[model samples]
Each structure stands twice: as structure tokens, then as C-alpha cells.
Target: SYGMVIGYCRGDHFPNVLYGYVMLAVIGGLYGCIGGGFLGLGLETTESKQPKWAQLLTEMVAGGMLAWGLLIYQLEWFMTPPRSELWAACLGAAIAMIWYMVRNKFDRALRVAIYSMLGAGFGFSFGNFIQGLGQASGLSYNWWNVMEFILGLSGGIAMAYAVATTKWEKTMQPSRTVQNLSIIFIFLILPLVNYFSGFTEEKIRDLAENLSVSDIDSFVLFQHIEAWLSITLFAAIGIAAWWQRASDRLQKWFSFVMLSSLSLCYTLLALIHKGFFHIELSIKNSITLYLPILFLAVWLGTSITQPWLNSSNSAGNKKIWQLVAGMTICIILIALISIYINNPTDRTPQRF
Candidate 1:
């Protein structure tokens, strides 16, 4: 809903349909909230207690039909709606019902999906805000997509840790100081960064659309540097905390710091890159680009290692790390092969 609001408010993509999109989101949210509340109340008041699956099935059907009707009405309001709109609405309703049924059976899947969606939404919005800041700062690189992807990944990890573990609160209880700091870092610090650094929609769109593959490669290098830098910084912190006999809360905070740093650094580098604003790359520009990577590498490490390094069971840790490494190598090899097959000469240094 908020994504729709932001997209509509931009006025570039949906000039004539801004009001319509906003109204659709508003109605959808309201309908979901009110109808859900009423239905929940009805379920609570029922005298004949139905089996949980039966109750869930009933809720899914009701919710799906309600969503379908609401979506169709909204789509019809369009001046010349596509027939696909009806099909899309039907698909959405079916997905919702199926999701509910599946979630009723597997609670963990529902938890993960809900958290993932929340993470994705927050990450996307935050990335947009950061892109705006980058534009305002005269940094012309387009890293908004990367920012969203990394932030979403971080959000998912953090949320999964928070939800999946029953011992999170207990584990962190001894380190109240660290937990409070983590909260501040995640909520207050990050949002402030976005507010201060984000770019406008028009600027972000222009840069993103114009960027080249080489520019992206340079950006990827920056990502690699940032990821390793974050991992190293947090690893050091974790080590120090262990030495000081700090609580597990510090470990959790370390995780957040690692994720947050990677996300933030990407956004900053994307903004600072000149490819978006300049036609030709210069030695000075190259030097400027290499400096951050160098500094971060020196401060952190040259490569990313697992976050659980300080924890025991080093052999088990190696196994998990090996699996991740294998997957990454496979992906890179496949991508390279695909590119080679597509255009052998395209491998030559090409600039936009």
C-alpha cells in the first residue's frame, strides 16, 4: 500500500492515474483491515467450534471473494482496462487463499513470507529515499536496485533471527545495553541516513535507465568491498565482545551492523560514482573509486567470511560456508558461460 502511495506521489510514472492508484490502495487496505476484523470477531463468537482447518478454509474463501470483488471494481474504474486486469485480480485472490491455507498448515512458512514482504517493502522505500539523497549530493551512479536488493536481504535475515528463535530475548537479556543500541542502529540511524541522502524519483529513474554494464561491474566491485568491510568490522566487534565476556546481545547487534553496513555502503557508493553524470571515465575518477575499496579492505578484510566465526563448531561452520561458496561459484560460472555463448566479442571492454 505504501509502495503504491510512493509511486503515485512521484507523478512521473502514473501522471493521470495517481489518484486512482492511491484510492485503490486505500480501499484495499481498509477493506482488508475491516473485513478481517469482522470475520475474526465472528470466528471468535461461533458456538459450534469447527476444526482449525475448516475455519481456515472458510476464512480463505470469504477473504478471497472479498478481495476479488474489490479488485475488479477498482480495475473497472480505469478508462480502458485490459482484460488481463480481471485475470490478475483472480490470480491474486487465488494466491491469497492458497497462501492462507498453506500458512495454516505450516506456520513457519507464513512467518517467513510475512517478514520477507515487510523487509522488501521497507528496503525498497528506504532505497528510494537514499537514491534521492545521492542525486542531491551530485553523485550520479545508479545503485538504487542494488540498495533495495541488499537491504531486503538484510531485513530478511534480521527478521528471521528475531522470529525463528525463542531464546532471542533471553539470550540478549544480559546485554540490555547492546540490544538498545541495536534498536537505535536499525530504526533510528538507518532512517536518518535515508532521509539525509536520498534522491528524487526523476533523478533515480534517469540514472538507473542510463547506466552501462561496465558501470554495473564497477558497482559490483564496490559491493564486494562493502560486504567484506562489514563482515570484518562486525567480526572484530564480536571478537572484542567475546574477550570482554559481553552478552550474546552483542553478537546479535554484530549481525545487524554487518548487514546494515553492506546496505548503506552500496547506497553511498552508487551515489558517489560519476558514471551517471560523466560520459568518460578518467584516471582521477578511477583513483577516487579505488580509494574507498582500498581503505575498506585495509580496515576490514579482502574477502567475506561467515558471521558466526566467533561461535564454536568451526568444522560445521566450514561446511555451511563451503555450501555457500559452491553455490556462488556455480552461479558465477554459469553467468560467464551464458555471456560467452551470447556474444564472445561482447566480453571486450565496452563503455556506455
Candidate 2:
């Protein structure tokens, strides 16, 4: 999950320093929290374990301290330095480590295969990012796009490992499927939370000056909706998964696959913006492709738990399949609906 946050926060990837954007905006039940008290989902106050005002003040101070600290640090340490070269070094180390660990599995012939895909992804993302920054005065740079390949490779492998670990190992029980789903989800959920962080509005505003939108109204609407639903879907899936507790393994695995798929989707997003879309935008370019996989693959897989059927009636695992399936479908539909409704998009959109 922490790794996911870093992925979404990659400043070079997405504009607006979306890093801090999520922190201040969305916390659970923010709609109910007022002055410093938690009113919970119902917005009905319960006993204040801590004084409301004190909590509010403390949260404020902490947030301020943290933000200022980061600001100082970036300005002093990272911001003062050249980002491209620095980021490149960092990314290179990561890519090396991933290949180091996994290289044995591949024959020499397969080396180029992994690197090629990674290179293409790297070039596309970095190229766009540099183009955006090219016009900025204080933020001028002459970094190579190939370095972004290292960044992307590092990012991809790190993301993969992050997913693999939580998805594969987080299962209290033995189930690869559940763990994988959970791992991937943690990635998606954090960014979703960040979308509500309130940082986006400013980030978008600042970037919009450099934006090339002949139709500002349309683009503005898209920016809002894309950010909004991105977060909502993450929350829906996360909460629903928790409520279902279908299987930690399934949760991790599904999320891992989803993020992996999103990485690919991101590439598609870049291509679309540059190609036919000609809108100078990158939306959930991968979502339509990913949605069906969720509906059919994980949702259906959870339904047909083989171990449960193979076991005796008294076996506890028997009901596990039923729970997984039922929850998968219920959660998917509910989440899908909730995400679309709360998103920038319209509910019952006449044509999706």
C-alpha cells in the first residue's frame, strides 16, 4: 500500500504534485467530521474519547508540521538538486535490483523482451512529462527519456513486488488468489483516497495554464470526474472487500493484477492522448479493459471455490466459495454503481 502511494505520487508521472493532494482531502467520514469530532457514517456524535477541539487542533498542527517539513526537505535536499539525474539514479538502482533477483529465471534471449516493453513505457511517459515541463521557467530541464525507462522499470518491478508480497504472503491461510487480489487493491485504494485530498484542484488549476484545451469546460469536467471516480472505485472495492473478508489472498491477488493491468492502461492513456483522442488528456484509459476482467475473472473465480466443493459438508471451507462468489458479484455491482455515481461521470449515463 505504501508502495502504491509512491507510485501514484511519482511527480514526474502525473502533474500537480498529487503527492500532497490526497493527504488533506479525504479521510474516512470527513463528511461527518467537524471542528475535530468524529460523527461517523451516520453523522451522529458518540462519546468523545478525546476532546473534540483538542483532537482538531492536534490534527491541524500535525498536518501543518508534516507539510512544512516536506516542503523544507524537498526545497533543500531534492528540489535544489537536478530531479532528472537524481530520479534516474534512484530508478536505475531499483531496476537493477529487480532484474538481479529475477534474472536467473530468464534466459539471455528473454532479457530484451522485458526491457523492451519497459523501455517503450518509459519513453512514452517521460516524453510527455518532459514536454509538459519544457515550458516551465523555474522547472527547466534537459533529462533524457531513457532515464524514465529506468524509473518506469523500477516502478513496474517495485509495484509488482509490492503486489506479489502482500498478495502472496498476506494470506493468513493458503490461498494465492485472495492474497494477490488484496495486494493489487491496496495500490488502487491509496490513490483513490488521495484523489479526495483536495490537492488536485490547485494542481489542475496550475497545470491548466499550460494545458491545451480548446474546450475548457469539457476538459475541466473530465479532470474532475476522472479524479473523483478513481478514488471512489478504490474505496468501494476496499470497503467491500473488507466487509466480505472473502479471503485475504483473493483480495491481494486481484489488486495486484488490477494495478499491473493499470500500468498497461496508463500506456494506452498516453497513446490515446497523443494519437486519435487529440484531447491532450489521459483518463482511465485502461478502465474499460480492466472492468470486464474484474467482473468475469476474480468475481467468477471466487464463486467457484474448488476446495470447498471437494471437501465434506462439515468442512468450513465449503461455504468459503459461496461467500467469495456472492460477495464478489455483490461488491462488484455495488462498487461499480457507487463509483460511477460519485464520480465526475453521470449516473445512468445515457451512453457510456
Candidate 3:
């Protein structure tokens, strides 16, 4: 959303690339807020005590604010002027997570957070290097998408590995409310936010044309269905889940519903844009567009197969030092790659 907005405002790729640093920081903040909040919630659930909603909210807000603040400070100081400043946001988020973890004494979760942060940091830079190689190869594929996939894949694997390998205390299952709300945010709210942000008037018109849509009124109706209709379906599912709040598999059911609904939304949008009977080779190439859905399906399958692992109180000073060393190594590696990919024509670093 901000990318499109900045692109339109700046009217050039170079300036947009510069401003994109700020946007990346903002995105980092969002990720930190979501990630930290979810982790805190999970940790709290492990105890027999009820959910501490206010404390969780505070931690989330603090994580987001700190991440954004640190990145902005670095940008203002022109720190690493020629290189990407996204690492600052990652560091800020890690610090915030550790601070709250220390407050709660969630040693095991803290280690997981540190490991995940390091994985994401390294994954992003390494993904960028791979993207650069792809671009240099003159391949017609979407290298940017490949980078995103790598970043997510590596970060996810790191988190999962951390959870599985570490011994954990038995945690109370998260309540239906927590599970439902998390699913809503992940599947409904997040996508809607992204959709609305990029759904400008010009974009709508272009989409209509691209879909081979001829009638403007028809397109308007299509938009309404795409937006409100899906919301209605989601709301119905939400209400049903609430009514059956006692179900043990509410999270799994909600996950399946959310993914299915989102997939339906995308399929309907495409079908409405282009007639059902019509087909094109461009449609074949657009398979890359739905790769996220595939990824999400795999993640969902994994979660269902292996529920949240039991956590332990085993993160010691030695592990902390190791994680710190790992993060430092990631920084140096990213720096070397950034220098290697540096191009005069490309003002933006060729990295995630």
C-alpha cells in the first residue's frame, strides 16, 4: 500500500526506493507488534492464570513503537546511508521481545525469539542475494516473490525448530476468543487492510480493464461483492464459532475456514474480472500470484499435525551469547552481500 502510494507521489523508482526504507521500517513495526503480541499471548497461556489482555497489548505497542523509533533514528542519522536500514528495525524488535520476556521470565520463549530474529535477518539478506542472481540471469520469473518466500520459509523453519527442540512447560490451551481473534486478524483484517490500501480508484479501473471487464457498472458491483460479500461470509463464520465456543478444535476449524474463505475471495475476484469461459496463457503465468495460498496451506497442515510444543525454562546466558554472536555474524554477512550487489544505476540495495 505505502509502496504504491510512495511510487505515485515520487513519480520515480529511485526516490521511491529511498522512501521505501521508511516503509520497510513501518512494516517491521507491524510484524514486531503481531509477532511479539502473539508470543506473549502464547507464553501467558502456558500458565494457569487467565489471559493478561492489557499487558499483552502494552507489549505489542511497545514492540511496534520501539522498532519504528529505532529505525527512524537510524534513518535520520543517515546510518549506513548506502545500505538498507531494515536491520535496525529487526534489532529493535528483538530487544523489545527480550525486554518483555525478561519481565515475564520466559527464558525459553526468549531464546526462540532471538533465534527467529536472527533467522529473519539473515534470511532477508540472503534472499536478496539470491534475487540479485536471478535478476542477473535474465530470468522472466518473479525474483521478488522468491525472496519473500525465502524470508518466510527460513523464519518459519527457525521458529518451528526452536519450539520443537526446546523442552517446554505444559501450557493451557489458548481460549476460543484468543484463537478466533488471531485467526481473524491473520486472515481477514490483514488482507483487507492490504486490499483497501491498494484498491485506489485508478487501480480499480485498471483491474477492470485487465480482467477484460467492459462494463463499469458491472465492475462496481464486482467490487462490492469482492469486499462486502466476503466480509459477510466471514462474519457468519465468526458468529458460528462463537456459538460453538466450547469446541476443542475451534482454532483448526477457524484456520481452515479463514484459508478457504480467502481462497474463495481471490477465486471469485478473478472469475468476476474475466468471464468463466474465457482463458488466457497470461492466466497460467499468474500462478505465481497464488503461491502464498499454497504456502499458507502448508503452514496450516503443519500446525494441525504438530500443535504448539511444550516450552521449558532453559534459555541460559550461554545461549544468549550464542544468539548474539549469530546476529552479529548475520550483520557482517549482509553488509558484504550489500556491498557486492551495490549498483550505481540501482540506488536501492538489491536485498529484502
Candidate 4:
């Protein structure tokens, strides 16, 4: 979902400058497009016997263009000269209007765009409110953290809405028990993980005093452990569900929820690094931060594709499985390449 992508891109909470905005736009757009393309390829079967490469390429390009155009518009409006909350509100309303007009025809595209814009507007407002509260309470203010929190929360809400509204085919419907279990997992278990993993001042102080570790070291260790545990739990659930032949609805729900929650957690961790402590993003600081989420994404992709491989009801099903398998491999390879590019080997902390 576009909301998920926007939330992930806000993890660093880029500086309020033209260059920073540009980077945010590019990252958000690319992430959304790549993710959307993969999902489309994995879930939808094509009637035309066109080459897989051509079909995938077309889908990717279309997704990229749509996300990039909308994100550019969003960033430019948010970052241009004389930024105002009023302007942000107006911009969000305008996008909502467009969404309404296009909802009947371009339902998917409009949903992503409208949700993203709405989330941005709400995040900005909530950030300002938090900043004010901090000032009034004589506490240290971290506007970036507030912004990240709002974006993550809003994005999660939007993605949840999308999942609820989707019209799944008869073959894809999950049993009531599975659906109820998903709701409990998402609404209950997820919030508990996030709450306990949150690096609040008290938690950090306890970690430091109890473990005799430096602040930065404790922060890094906590983040790494949390990411690994959370992602592993999600991947395990997804794999088990697929192996048990859970319905398509369950798989889809888990995928969207994992994506949304991962994005939220990623940004929350980043906010702890950059906002609370003023640490900069560097190889040593951020390399491991995103790795677990990427792994989870790839693992989920494999799980989704594996089912198609098992279903041999027709020649069409066989072809679909092959195409999806290729896509899954490609996604994993790209994630691995990214890990290499980010260079996770550096041990020195970028900041204390």
C-alpha cells in the first residue's frame, strides 16, 4: 500500500530541505512501485500468453510511474516555500476529491494515493500537537519522532482499511476462525510488541543501568533484537499458514498487516536513533535496522508463490506458478543486492 511505503520512507525523517524531500519522494515512489508490481504479479493470472518478462516489465513501469508522479506532487506541496498547515489540509482535501472522482474506475490507484495524502496531512497535524505538548510539559521535544509515529500509525490504519474492503474471489476466502485469528494477531499481539519494544527514556535507562552498556550500544542491541524477533515471528506465522493451506484471504491479510507493522516499527526505531539521540544515518548505524524487514518481505513472497506451485488444477495454474516463482526469486535477489550495497560490515558506531 502507498501508506506503508510513505511510512517506511519517513523512517529517516528527512531534513526539511529540497534535497531531503527529493530523496523521500524517490525512496517512497520506488518502494511503492516495486512492492505493488510484485504483489500484482504474484496474485493475478493473465489470460494473454505474452512473455512473462514483458508482462512484468509493463506492470512494474506502470506502478513506478503512478507512485512517482503522486509522491512528487505530495512532496512538492509539503516542502515548497511558505509551508503551512492550512496548505497541507487543503492539499489533502484536493487529493481526496480526486480520489472520489476516480474511485469507480481507478479504484486501486485512487485508494493508495488518497490514503497516502490523508496520512501525511494527519501526521503533520499530530506532530505539531506533540511538539506543543512537549513544550508545555518542559520535556525534550522531538518533532521528527512525532511525525514518524503519526505517519506509521496512519499508514497502518489505511492499509487495514484496504484489506477489509478488498473483494477476494470465492477460492480465496478464509474460514471465520482464520479471519478472527488474524484480527486478534494484528490488533492485539502487534500493539503489544510495539509497545514493549518501544525505546522510551525509562526503558533505555533501565537497559543501561541493568546491563552496564553504553546508551548507543544498548539502543542498537535492542533494535536488532526487536527487529529479528518481530520479523521472525511474522514470517513463521505466514509460512505455517501457507503450509497448512490457509485461504488466500488469510495470506493477503497477513501480508498487508506485516507490511504495515514493519514499516511502523522501522520508523519508530529510526526515530529513536535520529530524533531522541540526534544520531545520523550511516552504514554502521542503519545497515542492520532494515535487514530484518527485507528478509520478512522476501520470505512472505516465497510463501505466497509456493501455494501456486502446489496447485496443479490446470495448465494455466502451472504457468502462473512458474511466473510467480520467477518473480519471487527476483525479489529475493534484489533484497540481497541491497544488503550488499548498504554494506552491513562496518562495526564502528556512527554516533554514541
Candidate 5:
């Protein structure tokens, strides 16, 4: 999604930085909404009390509003120019999630958020530097996609490691209906929203033209079919949830199916964006398409094999200090590297 935004925001492309940033925030909010709301749904208080659906809604609203209204809009912190500023939104969402955890005393899960933020932040910065190196080498690869995959993989690993090392209470597990619904949101609904939202009508037309699709009308009809299929899938999931029979089976294979679906969706999306459908493969296109899949595979594999929340999880003062220091060094190094490797491109905006 950030890659698409970058393409659209380039001066030679759409030249709509404002639109880019707004969409970035919206993307962040959407992420926060799903992530935070699901986390809220998954955890329970010590007394076996669970958060109400309204409270989960509050997580979505708070995360979205804070991500949009705070640093992105009001404070105007353009910390990483030419890159998506959704980090601000992630932080905002983390704050909301942490607050809820503290309120509910789901303290064990707090490390998941903390470590995830740390890991993602480091991954993004490091990935940016790596991307710069790739570009400098003039390699025909999608470094941006590599960066995004690194970010996701690092965040997932950090969260999982945190969970694995921590001894968690056997809190109440949500019902099958709730679990199924949550899976649908994460694996299907939100991704579909992203697909439809990112591939706007204008974008589709541009992509179609570039791809030499003579029948633009038919191409658009194809997109409409995709959208309709999404709606049908969503409705089907809802019906399955209502019935409660199929949802269980659905959950068992949901990850694998979603992994394949998303990988194919993005690959097709990339082919259109790249304006070609051919047998010959570019290393860039391959990485851009498959790196996320690889990362997801790693995550899925580790999840199935790894023991979670079985060991002691402690964040002592020394560890906290070490984290802060390590993060500080990484930030400084990334800043220096970015400056040395390349000047900001058209996407970099002057905030002050």
C-alpha cells in the first residue's frame, strides 16, 4: 500500500502529496482499528471479565482519531519523509492499546505491543537504509517491498518472542464466532478494503492504460468482479459465523488460504501497476511479490512450532535501558545513512 502511495505521490505520477499523506493516516487508522480491536477482543481481565464490543469499538475510534488528529495533523511530525508517516498512527494505536491493557490488567500482553513497536521501528529504519543501498547499487529490485516485508516480519517476530517468553494467564478464550469474525477481519475484510481503496478508479484507469488493456471497460468490469467477490466472501463468512459449523473448519485453513490469496492479489496488482503481464520475471517484481509471502510463511511456521507464553517474561530496568540505547543508535545510524546514500526525492516534504 505504501508502495502504491509512493507511486501516486511522485511528481511524475499523480503529484498529490496531500492525498498521499491523508491516505497514509487512513491506512494507519485502519490498521489500528483492526489490530487494536482484535487485541481487545482476545484478552480478558483477571476476574474473567471481558471487554464489551462497545469497548472494542472505542479502541478503533480512539486509535483512528489519535493517529489522524495528533501528530499527523496537529503536531505535524514529518519524521520520515518520502516514507509513509503511518508510524505515528501505529504509536497512537499502541498508546490506546496499552491504556486498555493497563486498565484491564492484561499486563502480560503489554510486552507484545512494546516489543513490537521497538522491532517495527528498528526494522523500518534499517530497511530504509537497506533500500538505499539497493538503489545505490542500481539493482533491478523492489527495495521498498523488501523494507515493508522486513517491517512486518520483525514486528511479528518481536511480538511472538515476547509472547513466547512471557508466562501468560489462561484468560478466557473468545467463542468460535468471535474468533472466526476476528480472523475474517484480519485476513479478509481489512485487506479487501485496502485493495479496493488503493486501487481507485483513476488508478485503475492509469494502470489499465499502462498495461495496454485495450478494453478498459472490460478491465474495469474485472475490478468490479473482484469487489463483488469480496462482498460475497464477506457475506459468506458472516453466514458461516451465524451457523457456527463451517467457521471452525474455516479457521483451520484460513491462514494458508489468506496467504495464497493475498500473495496472488498483490502479484496481480503489481503486474497491473508495473504495466505488464509476461513470462519474463524481474528480480524487483519477484521480491515485491513474494517477500511478504515468505515472511508470512516464516511467521506461520514459527507460530505452529514455537511454544508461546511458556517461559518467564521480564523487562527489567537494564533491559529497558539497553533497548533505549540500541534504538537511539539505530535511529542515528539510519539518519546518517539516509543522508549519505541519497538526498530526499520528490516524495520528501518540508514540514517546517
Candidate 6:
């Protein structure tokens, strides 16, 4: 509905549509607020009445659809110069769909958390970029860019808030007394692949379409190599993380989130500081990339939970299954995230 309305607003045929859509957004905001209050200032579910599989399907579908739709929309958005007017249309549709999903009844805490983490991720990302340019010697953020960053932050917060408070998905949180340190170790090891992927250069993409074909072969090669290296590393990390995630090790759940967050540190401190367009394919980056793998290997050697040894015992089957189910959820979530941005360009340092 909002998409149609946004489209109509910009059409030369309908000047009246703009005012009505703005009014609708205002009204929709109120609707969300009122419904959210009734649902909860905040509430935790005590009953295990909800069906886990159905909720998992809903979450998988919702997360997948949002990622796929946004990728298609944003790709055209970021790449196109002639259709700048339609960007708002994409934004409106995204917000409307999110509102519909969040307003549904489900588990409040889980929704809030999923939304919060996503928000934090984006906020942290934008903040990193903003600071990156601001701190650069020759770069400056005028009033326009500052305003843009503020708007980005606001939009991210709103989206996160919508996701977190809604009872949309109901999956059990891992709170067993066992500490799953391997999960964290694996997450930490994933991003080293990003910084390390500089070894191979393939003709993967053409980022500088404006340049004459022969003018910047060297620059293009550099960018392509960087991209390949980064993405290869990203893939390696995902596989390693999933392997540990599936292991029957006792690790704290939050540790996994923290480990995943190492990508942020790499992006902001190292990637950004190095500046854009300077990334290259090289042997050094490739060799250093194995550091995370080595660290994780050491940690796995001392991990407290022994999955393989216990698997032979029949009564320990439940614990193994719990680990299996937990890994299933994590891998599904990781797969959903991977669908969005596979061939990450130099434009963005990629992370989930």
C-alpha cells in the first residue's frame, strides 16, 4: 500500500497523493505505538504453548523475504543515478512490511532482541563510516552528510524497535549451564578471512563503469582482488562458524554474538582507517588470514564439552540433539544473512 502511494505521489498525474501518504505514515506510527503498549511496555512469555517449528518458519520466511527484497531494491538504488526519486518508494515499502510483521502477536523478548541486534549492527556500521570520513585529513562532513547520518540512525532505530518488541517469533534461548566457548572462537575466526582474501584476483565485477575501459585497468584489478579476498574470507568464516556452532560444546550463547561482532572491529579500525579504494590483492593479507583459524584451533583443543565421545552413549543423545537444534537455528540464520550480499564490493566492507 505504501509503495503504491509513494509511486502515485511522484507521478505527474497526481499531486494530491503526497499529502495523503504523509498523513498515512503519521497515522501508522500512532497505530504501532498504541498496539505496542497493549502488547507490552514489555513482557516475557512463561508458557511453552507456541509451536516452535511454525515460528521458525515464520522467522525464516520473514527474515529471508526482508533480505531478498531489500537487496533487490537497494542494489538498484545504490547503483542507479537516474532514478533517485524512487528511493523513497523503496524505503516506504520496507517500513510498511516491517510494521505489518511486528504488529503480529508472538514472543516479545525474542523479537526485541533480533531487532535490537540488527539495529545495533547497522548503527555501528553507519557510525563507523561517519567517523571514518570525519577523521580523514582531507574529508569533511558538511551539514548535508551529517543530516543524512542522523536520518540513517533514526531509521535504523525505528526498524530495530519494531522488530524487538513484537511477539513475532518464539524460539528457545540457550540458557543451559554449559559454556559453549567454541562458538565464540569460530565467530572470531571468520573475519580474518576478509582481511586475508587478497591472494587471488579474478575479473569478478566492473565497479567503475564511468571510466573508459582502458583507463583504470590497474585500479579495477586492485578493487577486484580486494573484493575477492574479502568475500572468500567471509565465506571461510561462515563455514568455520557453522562447524563450531554445530558442535556439542557447552558455550554461552551471547559469546557467539560477541564473536560475530569481531567483523565490526576489523571493518572500523583496520578497513576504514586504510581508506577506500586502496584495498588490493596480496600475499601478505592471505597469510595473516590464517591467524584466526590457528587461534580457534587452539581453543578447540581445550574446549570443555566433548561431543564425539559422548555421542556413543545413548542417554547423552538429548544433549547432542540440543546442540544439533541450536546449530540448525544458527546456520539457518547465517544462510538467510548470506543471501543478501555475496559479491561484496569495495563500496561496503561486508558483515552480517
> Which predicted model would earn the best lDDT?
5
Leading candidate by TM-score: 5
Task: Report the poorest 10 consecutive residues by lDDT, candidate 1.
Answer: 165-174
- In order, what lDDT does every prediction score? 0.40, 0.35, 0.54, 0.41, 0.57, 0.38
TM-score, every prediction: 0.31, 0.29, 0.62, 0.34, 0.63, 0.33
Model 1 spans with C-alpha error above 4 angstroms = 1-70, 73-105, 162-352
* Candidate 3: regions farther than 4 A off: 1-37, 46-76, 80-94, 165-200, 209-216, 227-231, 234-296, 299-312, 316-352
Worst lDDT run of 10 residues, candidate 3, spans 2-11
Q: Any runs in candidate 4 off by more than 4 Å, and if so which? A: 1-104, 141-143, 166-234, 246-352
Q: How far is candidate 4 from the true structure (C-alpha RMSD, Å)?
A: 18.2
Assess the local accuracy of residue 140 in candidate 2 as a C-alpha lDDT between 0 and 100: 32
Residue-wise lDDT of candidate 4 within 326-350, one digit each (tens)? Answer: 5345433433332232322243111
Cα RMSD (Å) between model 6 and the true structure?
17.1
Give Cα distance to truth, residue 250, candidate 2, Å.
5.7
**Model 5 spans > 4 angstroms off:** 1-41, 44-47, 52-93, 175-201, 221-280, 286-288, 295-304, 307-310, 313-317, 343-352
Ranking by TM-score: 5, 3, 4, 6, 1, 2
Over the stretch 71-140, how does candidate 5's per-residue lDDT look in tens digits?
8779876655556677666556556766776676655555555655566556655555576678777788
Give candidate 3's root-mean-square deviation (CA, Å): 7.1
Tens-digit lDDT track of model 2 for 188-259: 654545444543555555545555556655655666665555455554555455455567676566554554
| Poorest 10 consecutive residues by lDDT, candidate 4 | 343-352
Residue 216, model 5: lDDT of 88
Model 3 earns a TM-score of 0.62
User: Which portions of model 2 miss their true places by more than 4 Å?
Assistant: 1-145, 152-189, 196-199, 215-218, 241-352
- Give the range where candidate 5 is weakest over 10 consecutive residues by summed lDDT: 6-15
Give the winner by lDDT: 3 or 4: 3
